[model samples]
Target: MVTTKLEIHGRVGVIFHAILEHRHYSADQPPESLFQFIDYSNKCLETVKRSVEEYCAAKERQGFFIEQDNLSMFYETLCVGYDWNENLEDHSPTAFAESSQPPLPLPLIQQQQPQPEESEGGKPPKINLSQQRERAAKLKYKDLADYFDYPIQEAARLLNLCPTVLKKICRQEGVPRWPHRKVKSLKKQMDKVKDFMSSNVCTVEESASLQESLNKLQRDLDITVAGGKIAE
Candidate 1:
């Protein structure tokens, strides 16, 4: 399962580290595979960048000043425990202390609520088809795996698709495909459902019913395979 606590922290750390390094690290390092670390870090940075841009755009649409202080605070919180060489000295003692304690169980991070539609007086946001296609192309196969009732690997095979293809499709569809370090949260699940609703894949009512069907399938599986009891 992806822990937002860890992911958010990791992303902040990577961004801070990138800023500190100025020069991007190559795919080669020592001890623990530097290439993988650099690759993952770059991906995390991209996700953060997109999120910040979106937030800024939304605020602008509302005729509000983007709160730089809040952004900085959020960045700091996410970077907690990140060993950015420069920030290492300023690491919060409290965070270190918390690290020593048995890790507290944390609830999943909820997705941010969708912003309200732009006011009638505001200019409408324009959609770029080229950018949309590029984004849609990045969806992960694993995210769509359950929709096909297959493990990620098997789903990839059945679809005759590479993981990269699945990821790209997700991006084109405007679905979040990164930092997929956890099972899809409920909000993400709904987002996927919404995507299907918008596409020619299903009608709105069919999409809703399909979601309920999937939920029922999950409940039945839990009861039969996991020995979970059905509540009245």
Candidate 2:
């Protein structure tokens, strides 16, 4: 499940408070326990940073990009308690040790062999529309939303459908209007349910459970579509 920014903020606050509460240190050197807490805090921050960067990249691929400067400013503001600044130089022994390490050798085996010929005129290869739509047909709207970041145009291109058709699918699938007050709530719920149902099914029992979940989702879609038809 995707965690909200406020939830992340609260987690960081708890971690900071715990560190301060248990802190025991000296002017010349910090206690070993302090190092452990600091390491844990760094891990939490690093995880959040990686997730944000990945999310930003995915959004950019779908024609949306967030400002990096704002993220930088937010990070720096959080570091104020540690007296961090852009002008500060790293003089720590750990930094020196890391910098002294030699680079590792390159991989001996190439995973991807080079294509024999480039596309003519330097243009990208065209997508096989039939194959693309076939693959899309196997995917649920929830799956398509996650893969394409919920942009109607991107999903439409893959599914070989117009924006209006995709919107109709969304309605049949019971996904609320994208412009509603809880804009992300619908997407987040879809992502959570679909991912959970698809993952970690090994035994027959688990497989049956997954099947039941899929059937339920299909039933909901059918009912919505039938109701709409009757209303018309």
Candidate 3:
């Protein structure tokens, strides 16, 4: 009988390790019960979440904070495998093989790419105002919050919005609120700043300055928007 195993393996911190094991029946087993796989996957995720939360809380109580980048790396490496027909297009055998390979490491390189313009005369292209507003309205606050590691309240405040209104906007945009708490660390903070800058709303120098400012603000503000002070 072919055996399918799902394993979660990673180092939580300098001295901590995390491993979760799960097994599912092979294709020869009753495939009609595949819905069990979904339940199994959910259980696996919940287990990982509980483990990581406990680990983080314990470390924090010990005055050793787990770096956000480390936490992100750990989650990224947690393998979630599903037992399915190898011949299925969505489950192509080659895809499984590729997923097992270690991701390539590369240095960060930024090259300026030219932006498309209306014409050589350099007149800025005209955009439909109504369409632009419609698109902007579609921007999901929850997804943005997740991307920036902020709570819905914090995200809404930063965007000069009402939490309920922003949440509705997110739902309209088909974006789900991130279920996990914001991971905290210098690396995560810098990453958030970089994302904001890359939105082309700010310059590199501005981004760097904002990153530094935000770090300082987080320390003072406790990374939450409270008492009318937006965390951003």
Candidate 4:
């Protein structure tokens, strides 16, 4: 078996790490799902390789070295090292493999001067980001408040926030200390969805339908975010 050697450095290393963090999905991701991920990961690594080569050439410093392989090897290492057993969830690969180098001075970015009073490159998105976040937050607040119950103590354990912080939020938001009336119904609905997602229906039509629904729902939720500034 043969493998390639690629030397990445500084910003390029950072870029590769970012791509790694974002690309891999769940442990249950099927073999068929890997083609696209591998393609994207390779493209990103290639771009970073080129960019780092040029940058390091200009800077005259020895860059970082990385072994180029199927990426699954690296990902497997990360999964075992990072404790991604059950849930097989998406987590940043960077958390397991941090940058080896200390922070260096960034290169100065040189940009072409634009004509005075020229319009910005593109029109902004009409949606409001803050509004979108508020919308999402409202859903989360309800989930934390009702599903987990008030003071949000036990529920806070499920999230990154401290119990005290969540309690503060509950108080500040004037959220009641009792579960919402919809909790039982919501739980049933969510359970059904989870079961469906975990099932292997094996029919092409069913798979296509599920994919279509998921895509449409994701688009809807993306558009629902409240922000004037659009995604870049």
Candidate 5:
């Protein structure tokens, strides 16, 4: 199921608000009581408690638990009273994803060589394909660089920059890498969707379905898949 904001905000935030309200409700001593630090702490807790209860009650009324994206504007509404309520809205998707996929012990451990191109010591570890004017390379800014086709000092002079500064700028800007194929593919998908929407050809239902398909594709595929497609 797609993670929804309602499950995050209404369910989790409500429980959090409830527990905090309980603590504030019973806080007569130090540490538990925020009255000393915050003005109208009691009222704040009350508002939080009321907001949570109301949200839960409303959700209970509608059978909204089945869908992944639980429809609820409760978090936005609660944002008026509590400053941190906005966090639930922002972090819900990320929090849900983290909960589903536990992190690896070491991310670097999984990064094995795709296929070693250079076992020889003299050559670089990766392929140096800069000379090739492939379609993939066309998407990058190299054409502009190639237009001048001058040596470092000359190119710097043309751009009204010092050679050292130009080198630094180039280093900072960096060249497009292998995984850039994925960015190109994603951009294509985005353009397709935009074109369809702007053309006024797709019916409302078709538009919604197309949006869903695009979203699913966006979520499921990454650089590896796109790069593989590019290789094929």
Candidate 6:
């Protein structure tokens, strides 16, 4: 059977002690040698498995859990180290590998920006965001409330989305298993805002502020109705 989760505090302790030993006994070695040693040790750990009782025992002793994302980042750093090692033709590959220079700093993660097509001439194409928002806002909170009266699958079908996606939206909105009552409550709140905006009791600045608040509430309600987090 495959291990869904693993606790490796003992393994980590061993590695930490080994690193300390290396630093003490082989003080002249470069940082790259230590990185290579850790990578080799991790590869060895990949083949081992522990029973449920053993895993629990390890957790009780000193638990360490590596999330999937962190593990991926760790592998990325290892790849960089391996590439650095491959580039050093003259350097000896050993536990006591010698180098006078310091190890290169790990590369920073850069977000990938959207690239323009060949026709765009380095400029991103114009997107009619207002029109998109208008379409999303078309499904009023009351209508959404009404839609939820049906089964989840049926309501999702009416909204032109799968049930799973609709449920995800509800979860994002922090509503119950379904958001019928939530939508109805938002609808009532919006109605109150509109009614207050129409009354002759506010100044221009206050009216503008009220309008902004209404727009924000509309967007929040529409996010649930739209069944996805549509970026502005």
| Alpha-carbon TM-score of each model against the true structure | 0.18, 0.23, 0.19, 0.19, 0.21, 0.29
Stretch of 10 with least lDDT, candidate 1: 30-39
Cand. 5 TM to true fold: 0.21
Q: Which residue pairs collide, candidate 3? A: none
TM match of model 2 to true structure? 0.23
Candidate 6 on 117-162: residue-level lDDT in tens?
Answer: 3333765444343354344435443345557656665675455443
What lDDT tens digits, residue by residue, belong to model 4 across residues 1-232? 1111222223434442222111221222311111001112345656755764574354333332232234333323223222221112333222233344432212222112222432265543232323543444444333453334323434443442333344334434454332323344444554565567668863667767766666655444333221112364
Give lDDT tens digits, candidate 2, residues 131-181: 654564455555443333445544454444534444544555565433222
For all candidates in order, the CA lDDT equals 0.37, 0.37, 0.38, 0.35, 0.35, 0.43
Instruction: Check candidate 5 and list the clashing pairs.
Output: none
lDDT of 1 at 20: 13
Q: Which stretches of candidate 2 lie over 4 Å from their true place?
A: 1-123, 147-150, 154-161, 176-181, 184-232
Q: What is the lDDT of residue 194 in candidate 5?
A: 72
Give the alpha carbon lDDT tens digit for every residue of 6-90 in model 1. Answer: 1122322444212111112112221111110112234565675675466457646655433232233433433334333323233
Choose the strongest candidate by TM-score. 6
Backbone clash numbers for all candidates listed: 22, 0, 0, 10, 0, 0
Q: Which segments of candidate 6 are over 4 A away from where they belong?
A: 1-146, 149-176
Candidate 3's displacement at residue 59, Å, is 53
- 5 or 6: which has the higher lDDT? 6
RMSD after CA superposition, every candidate? 19.0, 21.2, 23.8, 19.3, 24.9, 22.6
Stretches > 4 Å off in candidate 3: 1-138, 141-147, 173-232
State the lDDT of candidate 5 residue by residue for 122-146, as single tens digits: 6534422222213222332332344
